[model samples]
Target: MSPERGRPPRRAVVRAARRGLGYMPGTLLIAAVAGVLGLSLGAGGVPDVVPAGGGLTVNDVTSKAFGQHAPGLPIGELRHFTIGNRLFNTNWVIAPASVRSLDGLGPYFNRVSCSACHVRDGRGRPPAGPEAPMMSMLVRLSVPGPDGTPAAHPIYGEQLSDRAVEGLAPEGRAAMTWEPLAPFVYADGSVVPLRRPRLDFVDMADGPLGPGAMTSARVANAVFGLGLLEAVSEAHVVARADPDDANGDGVSGRVNRVWDHDAQALALGRFGWKANQPTLRQQAAAAMAGDVGVTSEHFAGGNYTAAQTDAAALPNGADDEGVELSRKQLNRLTFYLQTLAVPARRDTHNPVVQRGEQLFGAAGCNACHTPVMQTGATAAHGVLVDQTFAPYTDLLLHDMGPGLADGRPDGLASGREWRTPALWGLGLQKRVSGHTFLLHDGRARNAQEAVLWHGGEARGARDRFARWPAEDRAALLAFLDSL
Candidate 1:
């Protein structure tokens, strides 16, 4: 049974109220008790808190929280998961290095390893300033092309690699200048500042980017619970698409149909900010080629474009198996990503969190950040199949308005469209990644800012959120924090 259906227990309510009003004096506690008894404690009364990931949720809520494997993964597979973990954290060096298994860092690439961007399997943050090196983020580049596909930059290709091997000139350095917009005032008289990012390229090996080049700034997202998401039936995801807002909810979510190299056919995209990759394995392969300049079966050659003559001359790792990463190695990395567990929600029973939960639905945040979903039987792993989870995302693309648009179309996703990111381990980002940046490009500094930046399909929810009273806002935030 769903926890929200029943009346909350008295002890749970009192505990939640105590936690919610922890800063308040003793008198406030008396008042809170009275309020609870009067049935006016929360927005619509105390709500029941469900387990965020149902059976798959882990209990840890610390710096290492995002690194756990899903509970009950078979012991035999656990060994494979460990092998995959090593591959995930392995730092690749330049070709002809002492470490043959980890060689082939880059002829031209952004980082040397997967962990460089997705630090600790958590989210990546934007650079602190224009002078700061991009440690955990990257810039995607493209130009207008024939058909639906966005064309890769002729010189820089699809991504700009700011770093390269010993002899090659890096593509260019990427920096950002932020232009602050006027502050927006909420109905409750709170002011929130917003900023837009403008990307700049300097020291280009191929001179300036094409005049028509379109760019998108992307931050690495948390890598947990992806297996469960991948496990969701394609039919289930497609069924959620309401591209025309047929229900009149003012929210239209659609799926991105992308090419699956493995299948050699068009398939539903389930990963990336624009939902551009159809499978986790494919996503890993693309990252290997694009970010680390390490080739896999999917991308057998180096990441160099034909124009990157200097980069093409660099030595690359090759074996009878085909590319830099063996199929075994790629399988291990995919397994690692697939088994990383979702952290269990914290403070779900807190009165403020409970109230916020009610307000979250009331404000229509649940429209795209759908709270519950059931995994189907098609999961690659038995552990991920037939599980009901609370990932808090519909995993469909929604038009996020001009404020968040990258002005770069990806697959079926428009410039203004972004896939609804899962919010399961959101509150733990600061602990895991050492920062609180949110959203695709890491522009929003916190959850509040993230919500404030929402527009287009989410404008209604954002407006409703702004209209909420201070206490209600606190409750809503508390609820999000608990998640």
Candidate 2:
């Protein structure tokens, strides 16, 4: 008999029960064994299952799950969290509105609010088709510059904004067309079709994006667990760096050191698709400048290039107050992002999930999708201090091969490198954001497709997945879903 996609075989269930019941009292163990065998247990005979998120995880599975505050936030900080939530969800308008706080949107920008891209604190998907406009995703533009840094495109600057304020033309619109490739065959004769994206720039206001410009398509990632990722000790993350692959494990992970605006020095980057932003505060500030066309203390000037003189000349709301986003407001939004809770893993006790967990490690997925890390003392938020979390990422950049390359270098990350994304809330992405697209650009249609796209350092793990029997493949996916 074959195991169901999400249900483990009966034998697997029995094995899991025996293993989990070792410390149970005699009567409880007997009843657990009976339950595993499908014997009816009387009232009060059920065993207590351990919850996921290791106490930090929330059990909500609804669309609103990602928007919740972290469990156990101090009572005193609740008001601040609520204020931040309102600010995060507030839509910024063109400058000089009745409401002073929510004004100063872009003279040139992508979306009006942070929630526009994150979409309920969840992932963003690519455009549905060629006619679809890019709303939640943006294209990063750069060229090779001095000291291994990326030079902003002379005309477009760092990002291409497809929308602009009244009377001003947008830089350009971004469109995508997909080209299908030959179907990939597995060892067991199963096949998977793959598609690659072709990005097109249309209606350029300044002129042609010079042939030398390098572009990377980036989809907005989920906002949960960021504070925890931020809380991870720099020394601990650095300790995992193996840029030279000294162990010959076929995996070489490198650290991305970037400018920390508050620290006023170079610091290890742990945010963004390429790990280009050093801290969440700076990440928020960059988003304000680049995504919303709003200026803050970190980016006092609007995101306009010298070529965008028209945009630069626009009356920035900041001229009245000196900056668009105030220090208090920025801190509130940052706090809101820092406190979003990680959704608890569902169906963790199921036998199929257990089997999948074992297979995950066996396939060498753990080599880069590191399953565990401990948070050190976090000065930004006390809620994240000294917590052990399973974010399932090393937060280091790895060469994912030409298959997923954007041909754009960011900070120290090569064209083919991307920071390992956290897998904690992956299963709920479709539920929260209404899409299952994965990868940096939301190219992969599902987790399976995401795995098939892996290459370079992850070639061995990808091959292991490809070579697995259909049942094992289902098991592996089930394990990931449980997370």
Model 1: ten consecutive residues of lowest lDDT: 33-42
Clashes of each: 0, 0
Question: 1-483, model 2: which lDDT tens digit per residue?
Answer: 112344657886665545434446546654644443233444555434323344467888999878888888888788788998888778999988888777889989999999999999888889977789997999999977776578998888999999999989999988899889888888878787788889988999988897778999999999987888888899999999999999999998999999898999999999999999988889999999999988999899888887778888787777455999999889988888888888888876666665566566667787788777778866477777887667888999999999999989888899999999988877777789988888998888888888999999999999987886676787778878777
Error of 2 at 336 (Å): 0.7
For model 1, how does the per-residue alpha-carbon lDDT over 1-483 read when each residue is reduced to its tens digit?
Answer: 011223356675565455545545544543543342222344443423445665678999889888888889899989989998888888888877787777888898888888889888998889877888788888889998977579888888998899998878898988877778888787767777777677888889889996889999899988988988999899999898999999998999999999999899999998999999999999999999999989889998788899888878878876667688999999988988888888888877565566676567667888898787888967888888888778888899999999999999999999999999988887787788988788888888778788889999999999998876666666677677777
**Deviation in Å, model 1, residue 214 alpha carbon:** 0.4
Task: Write down the lDDT of every candidate, Cα atoms only.
Answer: 0.82, 0.82
